[model samples]
Target: MAERNNNEFEGKQKNIQILYEKFVILNRDLLNFGVSIEELKEICFKRRKTVHTVQGSQKNAQHSSFIVAVTVVCAVLISILLKIIFDSIIKNTLGTRCLLPNNYFIWEATRPETNCSMCEDVNSVLVFGNVTRDEFSNYAYSSRPMLVKGAALHWPAMKTFTYHFLKEIYQNVEGAYESIEEECQILTFKTEFRSLEDVFAMPESRVLLEEGEKPWYVGWSNCHPDVLAIMREHYTIPHFLPEDAEHAHMDYIFIGYQQGAVMHIDYISRLMWQAQLRGHKTWKLVPPPDCDHICSGISFRVDPGDIVLVDTRQWYHDTHIDAGEMSLTVSSEYG
Candidate 1:
C-alpha cells in the first residue's frame, strides 16, 4: 500500500513541471509581437509629418511668386510716368527761350484793327496786278495781314492740285520728307514723325471728321530738290515780293480737311504767304499777347483763288475749311 502511494506522487510532480515550461514559451512570443506593433506605429507617424511639411513649403512658394510679379508691374508703370513728365518740361522751357522773334512787339503795336469784313471799295487787299514792291514792303514792315486778289488764279496748280494728284506725287517721289502722324486737338497737340510714303498709305478713316473731333494737319516743309522742280513748273514767285525774296522756294504744303489749323502763334518765321488752291478757308486772327488788350480778334473768309500774306510771328491764327471736301494750300516764307 505504501509503494502504490509513492508512485502516484511522482506522476503528479512530472505533470506540474511540463505545464510551467509551456507557459514560459507562450509569454516570450507575446512580448516579441508587442515590440513589432510599436515599430509600425513609429513609421506611420514619421510619414504623416513629412507629407505635412511638403504641403506647407508649396503654399509659401506660391505666395512669394505673387508678390514678386506685382512689384515688377508697378515699377514699369512708374518709369513711363516719369519719362513723360520730364520730356514736357524740357520742351516748354526751350520753346519760350528760343522761338520768340526780335521785332515781334514792334509790329504788333502798329497793326490796324480793321473790321473783319471784305472791303467793298479798293482798300482791302492790293490786287495782284497792281501790287508794287514798295506796297508789299509797307505791309511787311507794319506786320499787317493782307489779301491779294487774283494772286494764284492764273497758276496751273490751281487747276491741277487734287487729292489723287497729290497722293500720286508723294508715292512716286522717292525722298525723305517729314510726315507727321498726330491727332490734332485744340488743347493738346501731339505729333509722331513718319515717312511721306507712310503718310500717303495711311487710311483716310483715321482722320474722318467726327462731331467734336479736330481736323488733322500734316505738312512737308523742307522738300527734296526734285519735288521743288515739279512744283516750280506749276507756280511762279509773286511779282510783288522783293527781288531778294525771289530765290525762296515753296516752304510748306499744308494738307487737311475741315477745321484746318488750330489757333496758335507761329514762332519760327516773320512773314508767310499761303495760296488757297482747292477749297475755301476761313481765318480767325488775334493780335499778339502784347497787343491783345488794344485790339479784338478778326475773322475773314478766303476762297480758292486768293493769296494771304501775314506776319505769322506777331499773330495768333486759326483756320477752318468748308466741309464735304479737302482744302489744300501751297505756302512759302519771305521777309
Candidate 2:
C-alpha cells in the first residue's frame, strides 16, 4: 500500500512539470508575436508621414510654376501694348513733319474782313489743288475757273478750251481777242488756244455762242498770242503753247487765278504752294470732324508764296480775293 502511494505521487509531480514547460513556451511565442505587431505598426506610420510630405512638396512646386508663368505672360502682354502706342505716336509726328512744299514752307495772308459783313450765300466753297484749267480755258493757256455749287462743274472750262483749241488747230481761225486791233483791250484781257474739255469734259458735245454785241464770255474762245508772249517773258521759265504738230492727248494744262475770285468748299486738296504776284486774297478753312475720317479727306488753297497742307480727300474750305489782285498757286498730289 505504501509503495503504490509513493508511485502516484511521482506521476503527479511529473505531470505538473510538463504543464509548466508548455505554459512557458506558449507565453514566449505570444510575447514575440505582440512585439512584431507593434514594430510593423510603427513602420507603417513613418512611411505614411513620408509619403504625405512628398506629396505636399510636389503640390507646392506646381503652384510656384503656375505663378511664374502667369507673371511672364502678363509682362509680355504689357510690353506689346506699350510698343504699339509708342509706334503710333511716332508715326503721327513723322507724317506732320513731312508735310512741306519742295521741302519748304509757304503761305500768304488772307484779305482782312471789310466791316464784318459776311459775303452772301458764298456758293461752291471747296478749293482743290493741282487742278489744271487747260480743259476749261476758252483760249490757249487761258486759266479757266471751275464753278462750284452742290457739285463742281468743270464742264464750262473744258468746253470753252476744246472749242478754241479745235478751231485753232483744224479751222486755223484767230480768236476774238487775237483779232482785236486795240492794244488797250488786248492788255486788259489776253487769250490763248486750249480745249475746255481738257479741263473738265469729254469732247463730244457742240455749244453755240451768241452773235456779236454780247459781253465777252468768261470762257476761252479766242486769245492774243502777243499779250501771252509778253506775260511769258516774265515767267521764271516761259510757258508757251506748242505748235499743232506737237499736240498730244495729254498736253499743257491751264491754271491761273482771276483778279477777284470767290470759292467755297466741301473737301480739301492734296497739297499746294502759292505766291502772290499782284493781288491779296482771303481764305477760310474748316477743320475736319474726327468721326468722319480726318486723315483721308482734305484739300488745299494758295496765297502768294504760301504753302497749304490739307488732307486731299477730306476737309472743306473757301477762298476769296480783292480787286486788282493776282496770285500764282502751285499744287501736288499724294496717297
Candidate 3:
C-alpha cells in the first residue's frame, strides 16, 4: 500500500509538472506582456498576481491590458484546479481525507526552503529533561529537533484531558459548534468521524475503547477563542520557548486509541511544539527530497510528559502511538 501511494504521488507530481509546462506554453505570450517566469510560477503556484508595467505604443498598452485581464481569470482557474489536485494528492498520500489547517497551504510542495546544511550530521533528536529559553532557541528556527522530557509535568491537561473533559471544554463555550461547522480544521485520519461534531457525537462505547469497538485517531485545531481560552486554562506555555517567539492564536488537540497521522510536510508559519500528555508514540522523520542524498532519516519516541519541538515545515513526518494507551497531545506553533 505504501509503495502504491508513493507511485501515485509520483504520478500526480508528473501530472502537475505537465500541466505547469502546458500552462507556460499556452501563456507564452505573457512573457512578451512582461510576465517573468518566476512571477508566472508564483501566480500558478500561490495564486498571487504580480503587477507588471507594459512599455510600448498605445495599441500595445491596450493589448497588454486585455492580456492582464485574461491572466487574472486564468490564474483563478488554475488555482482552483491546483487546489483540487493538491487536496487529492494529500488524501491519497495520507490514505485518509483530512483538511489542512487554515494556515497550511500547498506552497510547500512546489518549493521547500530547507537548508541542507542544517540536516547535516543530525542522526537523531537531542534530548533533555528540561531546557531554558535561550538554550532551546538555538534549535528553534532550524530543522534540528529536540525532545524535552517532563515538559508537561505541570500541565493540568496530563490528568484532565480525557474525551469527556475535552468534550465539555467545547460544550461550555458558546458557538463552538458554529465555529467548527464553518472554519476549524479537523484531521480524522483513518476514522469515520468526518467532523468535530461527529467526533463529539460518537457513542460512549466507541469513544471509551470498550470491547469490540473499532480503533480510531483524530485531531483538530481549537479555532474558537473561547474554547482555546478554556483549554489554555489547563496548561501553560513551555517555559523553554524563546520569549521573543510569538504564539499562534490557535492550538491543536490530538487524541485517540491507535494509528496516527501520515507522513507529510507542514506548510506552517512557525516552529511547532507538541506535549505528549498521555501514552507513547514515535515520530518518523525524513529530510526533504533535495537533502535525501546528504541527510539521513531517523525515528524517535515521545513518551508521556515528553515535549517534542521541531520545525515540522522543514521535515516530512509521520507518527503512530503505541496500541495500549490512549494518546493525547496539545500542540501550538510559535514564530
Clashing pairs in 3: none
Deviation in Å, model 3, residue 298 alpha carbon? 0.8
If scored against the real structure, what TM-score would every candidate get? 0.55, 0.22, 0.69
Q: C-alpha displacement of 186 in model 2, angstroms?
A: 23
Cα lDDT tens digits, model 1, 1-335, are 33544454455455545544643553344344342334323322222111112355766455345334433433444454445455544444333322222233544565555432322122233344457778766555445668887778989999887656777765666653322212110111233424445546656564454556545555655346666777777877776777766344445677767676667666544478889987888888776555544556667788887888876666678888887656788888776
Task: Output candidate 1 Cα RMSD.
Answer: 31.9
- Measured by C-alpha RMSD in angstroms, how accurate is candidate 2? 37.0
Regions of candidate 3 where Cα sits further than 4 Å from its true position: 1-109
Give the clash total for candidate 1.
0
With candidate 1 superimposed using the best TM-score fit, by how many Å does residue 213's alpha carbon deviate from the native? 12
Tens-place lDDT digits, model 2, residues 1-335: 33554565565456556655754564454345342434323333222111112355766555445434433543454455455555544444333422221121121122222221122222323343443334322322211112211111222221233334433442343342333322211111222323332322323231221233111112221234543333333332111121331221111121323332222231222222222332344554443333232222222334443333333232234445543332333222221
Model 1 misplaced stretches (Cα beyond 4 Å): 1-130, 134-137, 177-195, 203-216, 246-250
Scanning candidate 2 in windows of ten residues, the lowest lDDT window is 245-254
What candidate 2 gets wrong by more than 4 Å, as runs, is 1-278, 289-303
On a 0 to 100 scale, what is the lDDT of residue 40 in model 3?
A: 62
lDDT of 3 by residue, 1-335 (tens): 55677777777777777777867675787777665677667666666655456686786677557556766767766876678597766668455334334214444546656689877899999898768877877776666888999989888888998889988877778889777655667878778877887889989998878889998899888889889888999998899887878999899999998778888777678889999998999999998888998999989999988999887887888898887778999999987
lDDT of each: 0.58, 0.31, 0.80
